[model samples]
Target: MASRKPSTDDTTHKLKEDLHHLTQTIEDLVSATADDSRSNIKELRARAEKRLKETRDRLESRGERLYDEARDSVTHQVDACDRYVHDNPWTSVGLGAAAGIVIGMLIGRR
Candidate 1:
Protein backbone atom coordinates (compact mmCIF):
# COMPACT_ATOMS: atom_id res chain seq x y z
CA MET A 1 0.00 0.00 0.00
CA ALA A 2 1.17 3.51 -0.82
CA SER A 3 1.43 5.97 2.00
CA ARG A 4 -0.35 9.26 1.39
CA LYS A 5 1.53 12.48 1.93
CA PRO A 6 0.00 15.37 3.85
CA SER A 7 -1.80 17.90 1.65
CA THR A 8 -1.33 21.66 1.87
CA ASP A 9 -4.77 22.04 3.44
CA ASP A 10 -3.92 19.50 6.12
CA THR A 11 -0.62 21.23 6.87
CA THR A 12 -2.30 24.63 7.04
CA HIS A 13 -5.01 23.29 9.32
CA LYS A 14 -2.42 21.78 11.64
CA LEU A 15 -0.52 25.04 11.74
CA LYS A 16 -3.66 26.99 12.54
CA GLU A 17 -4.52 24.57 15.34
CA ASP A 18 -1.02 24.83 16.81
CA LEU A 19 -1.11 28.63 16.65
CA HIS A 20 -4.54 28.66 18.35
CA HIS A 21 -3.29 26.37 21.13
CA LEU A 22 -0.20 28.51 21.64
CA THR A 23 -2.31 31.68 21.75
CA GLN A 24 -4.67 30.11 24.29
CA THR A 25 -1.83 28.91 26.48
CA ILE A 26 -0.15 32.29 26.46
CA GLU A 27 -3.41 34.07 27.23
CA ASP A 28 -4.02 31.71 30.11
CA LEU A 29 -0.54 32.33 31.48
CA VAL A 30 -0.93 36.08 31.24
CA SER A 31 -4.35 36.04 32.90
CA ALA A 32 -3.26 33.64 35.60
CA THR A 33 -0.43 36.01 36.52
CA ALA A 34 -2.61 39.12 36.31
CA ASP A 35 -2.65 39.49 40.08
CA ASP A 36 1.10 39.22 40.45
CA SER A 37 3.00 42.36 41.46
CA ARG A 38 6.47 41.25 40.37
CA SER A 39 8.16 43.45 37.75
CA ASN A 40 9.97 40.50 36.13
CA ILE A 41 6.77 38.51 35.63
CA LYS A 42 5.07 41.57 34.16
CA GLU A 43 7.94 42.10 31.75
CA LEU A 44 7.95 38.42 30.75
CA ARG A 45 4.25 38.48 30.16
CA ALA A 46 4.50 41.57 27.99
CA ARG A 47 7.25 39.95 25.97
CA ALA A 48 5.30 36.77 25.55
CA GLU A 49 2.30 38.72 24.32
CA LYS A 50 4.42 40.61 21.79
CA ARG A 51 6.08 37.45 20.54
CA LEU A 52 2.74 35.71 20.18
CA LYS A 53 1.36 38.57 18.09
CA GLU A 54 4.43 38.53 15.87
CA THR A 55 4.22 34.75 15.48
CA ARG A 56 0.56 34.91 14.48
CA ASP A 57 1.24 37.61 11.93
CA ARG A 58 4.17 35.69 10.49
CA LEU A 59 2.15 32.49 10.25
CA GLU A 60 -0.67 34.24 8.44
CA SER A 61 1.72 35.81 5.97
CA ARG A 62 3.55 32.53 5.35
CA GLY A 63 0.33 30.61 4.97
CA GLU A 64 -0.87 33.00 2.28
CA ARG A 65 2.41 32.69 0.42
CA LEU A 66 2.35 28.90 0.66
CA TYR A 67 -1.23 28.78 -0.61
CA ASP A 68 -0.35 30.97 -3.56
CA GLU A 69 2.65 28.80 -4.39
CA ALA A 70 0.67 25.59 -4.22
CA ARG A 71 -2.04 27.05 -6.40
CA ASP A 72 0.49 28.06 -9.02
CA SER A 73 2.14 24.64 -8.94
CA VAL A 74 -1.15 22.80 -9.46
CA THR A 75 -2.20 25.19 -12.21
CA HIS A 76 1.06 24.67 -14.02
CA GLN A 77 0.76 20.88 -13.74
CA VAL A 78 -2.82 20.89 -15.00
CA ASP A 79 -1.98 23.16 -17.93
CA ALA A 80 0.88 20.88 -18.86
CA CYS A 81 -1.30 17.82 -18.69
CA ASP A 82 -3.92 19.48 -20.84
CA ARG A 83 -1.34 20.43 -23.41
CA TYR A 84 0.01 16.88 -23.46
CA VAL A 85 -3.43 15.42 -23.96
CA HIS A 86 -4.16 17.82 -26.78
CA ASP A 87 -0.86 17.04 -28.45
CA ASN A 88 -1.15 13.25 -28.10
CA PRO A 89 -4.69 12.05 -27.50
CA TRP A 90 -3.97 8.44 -28.40
CA THR A 91 -0.94 8.29 -26.13
CA SER A 92 -2.93 9.78 -23.29
CA VAL A 93 -5.70 7.23 -23.82
CA GLY A 94 -3.19 4.38 -23.79
CA LEU A 95 -1.56 5.67 -20.63
CA GLY A 96 -4.95 6.08 -18.94
CA ALA A 97 -5.93 2.53 -19.88
CA ALA A 98 -2.64 1.14 -18.55
CA ALA A 99 -3.10 3.04 -15.31
CA GLY A 100 -6.66 1.72 -14.95
CA ILE A 101 -5.48 -1.82 -15.56
CA VAL A 102 -2.74 -1.48 -12.96
CA ILE A 103 -5.20 -0.04 -10.42
CA GLY A 104 -7.68 -2.83 -11.19
CA MET A 105 -5.03 -5.46 -10.63
CA LEU A 106 -3.95 -3.86 -7.37
CA ILE A 107 -7.56 -3.87 -6.15
CA GLY A 108 -8.01 -7.48 -7.25
CA ARG A 109 -4.98 -8.47 -5.22
CA ARG A 110 -6.68 -7.20 -2.08
Candidate 2:
Protein backbone atom coordinates (compact mmCIF):
# COMPACT_ATOMS: atom_id res chain seq x y z
CA MET A 1 0.00 0.00 0.00
CA ALA A 2 1.13 3.52 -0.82
CA SER A 3 0.21 6.82 0.88
CA ARG A 4 -0.40 9.91 -1.24
CA LYS A 5 0.77 13.37 -0.26
CA PRO A 6 -0.83 16.69 -1.17
CA SER A 7 1.35 19.31 -2.87
CA THR A 8 1.24 23.10 -2.36
CA ASP A 9 -0.02 23.91 -5.87
CA ASP A 10 -2.75 21.29 -5.54
CA THR A 11 -3.76 22.77 -2.21
CA THR A 12 -3.87 26.29 -3.63
CA HIS A 13 -6.02 25.21 -6.55
CA LYS A 14 -8.33 23.34 -4.19
CA LEU A 15 -8.70 26.42 -2.01
CA LYS A 16 -9.72 28.55 -5.01
CA GLU A 17 -12.23 25.88 -6.05
CA ASP A 18 -13.61 25.72 -2.52
CA LEU A 19 -13.98 29.49 -2.35
CA HIS A 20 -15.90 29.60 -5.64
CA HIS A 21 -18.16 26.77 -4.52
CA LEU A 22 -18.83 28.34 -1.11
CA THR A 23 -19.64 31.71 -2.69
CA GLN A 24 -22.01 30.12 -5.17
CA THR A 25 -23.62 28.12 -2.39
CA ILE A 26 -24.13 31.16 -0.18
CA GLU A 27 -25.58 33.11 -3.09
CA ASP A 28 -27.93 30.26 -3.89
CA LEU A 29 -28.95 30.01 -0.27
CA VAL A 30 -29.62 33.75 -0.05
CA SER A 31 -31.66 33.67 -3.25
CA ALA A 32 -33.63 30.72 -1.94
CA THR A 33 -34.49 32.65 1.27
CA ALA A 34 -35.53 35.66 -0.79
CA ASP A 35 -37.80 33.37 -2.79
CA ASP A 36 -39.19 31.85 0.48
CA SER A 37 -37.47 28.47 0.01
CA ARG A 38 -36.98 27.24 3.59
CA SER A 39 -34.97 24.08 2.79
CA ASN A 40 -32.03 25.87 1.20
CA ILE A 41 -32.08 28.57 3.84
CA LYS A 42 -31.82 25.94 6.56
CA GLU A 43 -29.04 24.06 4.78
CA LEU A 44 -26.98 27.19 4.24
CA ARG A 45 -27.45 28.34 7.81
CA ALA A 46 -26.25 24.93 9.07
CA ARG A 47 -23.19 25.05 6.83
CA ALA A 48 -22.33 28.55 7.99
CA GLU A 49 -22.72 27.60 11.64
CA LYS A 50 -20.43 24.59 11.18
CA ARG A 51 -17.81 26.71 9.45
CA LEU A 52 -17.87 29.28 12.26
CA LYS A 53 -17.43 26.58 14.89
CA GLU A 54 -14.44 25.10 13.06
CA THR A 55 -12.85 28.52 12.58
CA ARG A 56 -13.26 29.40 16.25
CA ASP A 57 -11.77 26.10 17.36
CA ARG A 58 -8.75 26.60 15.10
CA LEU A 59 -8.17 30.15 16.34
CA GLU A 60 -8.44 29.19 20.01
CA SER A 61 -5.93 26.35 19.56
CA ARG A 62 -3.49 28.57 17.68
CA GLY A 63 -3.79 31.31 20.31
CA GLU A 64 -3.07 28.79 23.05
CA ARG A 65 -0.02 27.54 21.16
CA LEU A 66 1.28 31.11 20.69
CA TYR A 67 0.84 31.89 24.36
CA ASP A 68 2.63 28.71 25.32
CA GLU A 69 5.55 29.63 23.07
CA ALA A 70 5.98 33.05 24.73
CA ARG A 71 5.00 32.08 28.27
CA ASP A 72 8.51 31.11 29.47
CA SER A 73 10.25 34.17 27.99
CA VAL A 74 7.63 36.53 29.41
CA THR A 75 7.75 34.89 32.84
CA HIS A 76 11.56 34.99 32.94
CA GLN A 77 11.65 38.70 32.04
CA VAL A 78 9.09 39.55 34.67
CA ASP A 79 11.00 37.56 37.29
CA ALA A 80 14.25 39.32 36.41
CA CYS A 81 12.55 42.70 36.77
CA ASP A 82 11.08 41.63 40.12
CA ARG A 83 14.54 40.66 41.40
CA TYR A 84 16.04 43.97 40.22
CA VAL A 85 13.25 46.03 41.79
CA HIS A 86 13.57 44.09 45.07
CA ASP A 87 17.32 44.58 45.14
CA ASN A 88 17.18 48.33 44.42
CA PRO A 89 13.64 49.64 44.68
CA TRP A 90 14.49 53.34 44.29
CA THR A 91 16.81 52.92 41.36
CA SER A 92 14.49 50.42 39.65
CA VAL A 93 11.52 52.72 40.09
CA GLY A 94 13.39 55.72 38.67
CA LEU A 95 14.75 53.71 35.74
CA GLY A 96 11.37 52.17 34.95
CA ALA A 97 9.59 55.52 35.12
CA ALA A 98 12.28 57.16 32.95
CA ALA A 99 12.07 54.34 30.41
CA GLY A 100 8.28 54.64 30.32
CA ILE A 101 8.50 58.38 29.76
CA VAL A 102 11.03 58.00 26.99
CA ILE A 103 8.91 55.32 25.27
CA GLY A 104 5.81 57.48 25.59
CA MET A 105 7.58 60.44 24.00
CA LEU A 106 8.86 58.33 21.12
CA ILE A 107 5.45 56.84 20.48
CA GLY A 108 3.86 60.28 20.64
CA ARG A 109 6.21 61.54 17.95
CA ARG A 110 5.27 58.60 15.70
Best by the TM-score measure = 1
List model 1 lDDT by residue over 13-34, tens digit each. Answer: 9778767767776776677586
C-alpha lDDT values of all predictions: 0.81, 0.74
Residue 102 error, candidate 2, Å = 11
**1-110: candidate 2 lDDT, tens digit per residue:** 89764465865675566566667666766777787777778988788666556555655765675677589789999999899889999998899899999999999998
Alpha carbon lDDT at 43, candidate 2: 84
Please name the candidate that would achieve the greatest lDDT relative to the true structure: 1
Give residue 53's error in model 2 in angstroms: 0.4
**TM per candidate:** 0.60, 0.44
Error of 2 at 59 (Å): 0.9
